[model samples]
Target: METNTQILSTEDLRSQEYFLNMGPQHPATHGVLRLLLTMDGEIVKNIEPDLGYIHRGIEKMVEYDTYRQIIHVTDRLDYLSSHMNNEAVALAIEKALEVEVSDRIKVIRTMMDELTRIASHLLWWGVMGMDIGALTTFMYAFRDREMINEIMEKTTGARLTMSYNIPGGVMFDLHPDFVKDVKAFIPHMRKVLPEYDRLLTGNIIFQRRMKGVGYLSAEDAISHGASGPVARGSGVRCDIRKKAPYSAYDRVEFDEIIETGGDNLARYQVRMREMYESLNILEQLVDNIPEGPYQMPMRTLIKLPKGEFYQRVETARGEFGVFIVSDGKKNPYRVKFRSPGFSNLNALIQAGRGVKLADLVAIMSTFDFVIPDIDR
Candidate 1:
């Protein structure tokens, strides 16, 4: 037996590496983020995130604004979790002032935080499907999200950038229809979530696209300071709600969803399971909402005692921390926010490398980051 084989020349094997700009205007980047990706064919060799496209110098602005005025500014950072962001500042102020709000306010704050979380997750779910080519999921997700949005609007009087939380309490009491609508929507969500699962979660294509893709280990997640579903998916127990209870979170019974898979599918599952946990929390507290004034009387001019105070809350994306330094004045001497998206985005370069170009979308989607939050 005789066989002949021909080898290719060096010039035939040479390949040029090229860069692809994901956005300062692309849909997948989600909010003016530009990702400069280095690629070898379809495999991603490196990722460099170019931020500050939407930077507003929020921290510098906070120095001149009064304590009360700072509440509104926080909403713009992560508009999807506006209420929670407001809560972080409010809680910090309360601690500085030695103010413990009434039970009614605590319960209401907890309810609103959960609602914000669910709404954020729903939006992420819709946009995630759209990124992956399932346009129908977007429609279904928004349809249900509108119901929650209406509930928020009725109580807070603003949709996305709702400045609902105030120092010592919420700005207003729950609306008359608030409990009723939430009660109705709970069962509705219970019904619709399964449909969402059937429509996409179980789809073989989605599973293949997500499972074992964008893998991050527990060590890497911690090193990157990832939190919420991003950290939870990699088996990191870094939930602020469970670890350090604020408002009425100490009184609620809900599991911190954890997945050890450390892939896109794992992150997806963590958020999906969290929705049910949020519903469970609402079910327990909606009927038992104590009757009391939503807020306490405050002086027209708000000032914090000279010192530094810090507070952290579990937002839909992750742990949002607020650090305030006051000099016994109406305005803070300095203010800083340890934004979750900024820390989580740092993990992108690590997880995205070595994965296929398309898998990067799944990885970024799993992070569910808001660019304004990162830019801030």
Candidate 2:
């Protein structure tokens, strides 16, 4: 028998690059984010994020709303960090008015802010696990997060978007059980958080997926304006609470978490350690809540002076800044929010470059952004 051989052409051997759309309807996105991906085989070559699916013109809406009503608009920007968002706007307004909130209000706000941070991180932890195929972590994360929701509902009358912070101070006094519940949570979280390490952090599979993936450096993080865990993962010290304290954060002593690895694992570890620091903050203030009115008596209408005012707060995801140009009007002349998600999202393309398509999900999860914050 005669032997026959076949030769392949260059075109037959070449791998064709293709484009893929990840969302506007994908679970991995966590929102209506649309990512246009260019891929060569399994490796990602480019990422273009198409935003505005959920944009409600929050900044424009704030211009028509009063100072007191502005906080509510900010609520929908990052529902998970609503309390901190509200505080940012309230602080800006208060600064414009030159009014001092009571120490009691400050203490309660600080505690509530920490609670919000922990709650947001809980969701991030669970979703991150789910993104990487560890389903059990989803259940365990929500178990502890529910406790914080209950605690928040009791005080703010809403679990996610509290709308609790107002121009002068908070909406209402802390629930009678606020201190007791927070104290209880501190112990419970300390116990529950360690289980997270065992379930996912130490798992060989998870370690392999996260350890060297989605690497970003301190210089890139700074140039891209990343914040919160995204920046800290790259050894960038950008925690607003530590760098520039607002809303009783100056009174608390806590370590700023930083990781030099600049990988997915580094980001994960940053958030994990942050939860403990939040616990530390709660411990220091739980028993020390001062006795005073939660809100100051305000005139029916709030009129800020004709000047620009800015306030920044450390939210669960990153720095949430509110800037207002008053023009001595009932409503702000111009309203702008410096949301962390937008800046963090800008870095995704850089980080996702050359990473596997599957690993992109893990990379984004580690960034831990709330999409509406960017959409706004």
lDDT of 2 at 110: 92
RMSD of each: 2.1, 2.7
Model 2 worst lDDT run, 10 consecutive residues? 1-10
Q: By lDDT, who's the top model here?
A: 1
Measured with C-alpha atoms, the lDDT of residue 154 in candidate 2 is 97
lDDT (tens digit, per residue) of candidate 2 on 184-296 = 89999999889899888999999999999999988888898889899999999999998888878899999999999999999999999999999999999988888888899
Question: Residue 47 CA error for candidate 1 (Å)?
Answer: 0.8
Tell me each candidate's TM-score: 0.97, 0.96
Deviation in Å, model 2, residue 188 alpha carbon: 0.8
In model 1, the clashing pairs are none
Q: Report, for all candidates in order, the number of backbone clashes.
A: 0, 0
Question: Model 2 scores what on Cα lDDT?
Answer: 0.91
Clashes of 2: 0
